[model samples]
Target: MFDQSRGFRDDAVETCPVEYVVRKDGKPFAFLNATPALATRTVTGFALATPEADWTFERI
Candidate 1:
């Protein structure tokens, strides 16, 4: 799955590609790619960065 979020600035946007997986026990998890697309306006100019992210869910 692909996702996008608005940056601190209205004109900036961050995008990432994710993947979901289920273990043998049926537990599910998701993670984002190492490199994500970023658009931010900095004092110097536009800059890019990579963020590490992961997600896990549990039944209540």
Candidate 2:
């Protein structure tokens, strides 16, 4: 998935990297960092609205 919300920037602001992993039970799991980013600076006291449950996908 490609997100272009912040446009193309070298600082990678508002970017969230996602990785897929397999759990011990062999179930696919997605790990993502929802932390907000600032250009060449540290973000403090910032909160993003994230889903409370894990994301699920179904094949058509």
Candidate 3:
């Protein structure tokens, strides 16, 4: 059960190393926040968004 509302932009592109970057929902941080360390301001990690897509930890 995958929720499509989780910012999975452009679901048509079936390829990866696709970055899963999520910035603060509002204006506070000047950068696009990513994941894994959500406790801090910026979260950074990897996401194999679909069977075809994945964001490697290196690019982040």
Candidate 4:
């Protein structure tokens, strides 16, 4: 994922990559690209919304 949200310079905010893995019915189902800050929240929300499935994130 390309996240243009953080950096030391305002005009040159570097993009950060985040990867998300979500499972359904005990099987991997989705791979998402998201912002680093939002990655954790996204996984948490998914786990909460879909209690039967598992979710996780990987920093790249």
Task: Please report the candidate that would top TM-score against the real structure.
Answer: 4
lDDT of 3 by residue, 4-54 (tens): 787555633443233443333322333333333342222323122223333
Model 4: per-residue Cα lDDT over 1-60, one tens digit each: 333565244522234445666556656767777665566677788889878765655543
What C-alpha lDDT, on a 0 to 100 scale, does residue 51 get in candidate 4? 80
Which prediction has the highest lDDT against the true structure?
Answer: 4
What pairs collide in candidate 4? none
Off by over 4 Å in 3: 1-31, 34-36, 39-48, 57-60
Clashing pairs in 1: none
Q: Relative to the true structure, how large is the alpha-carbon lDDT of every model? A: 0.26, 0.33, 0.34, 0.61
Could you give me the TM-score of model 3 versus the true structure?
0.18
Regions more than 4 Å wrong, model 2: 1-7, 17-24, 29-60
* Candidate 2 lDDT: 0.33
Ranking by lDDT: 4, 3, 2, 1
TM-score of 1: 0.15
lDDT of candidate model 3 versus the reference = 0.34
Q: In candidate 1, what are the lDDT values of residues 1-60, reduced to their tens digit? A: 333453244422233333323122233432223212211122112112212323222212
Between candidates 2 and 3, name the one with more favorable lDDT: 3
Instruction: Please say which candidate is ahead in TM-score: 3 or 4.
Output: 4
Model 1 lDDT, full chain set = 0.26
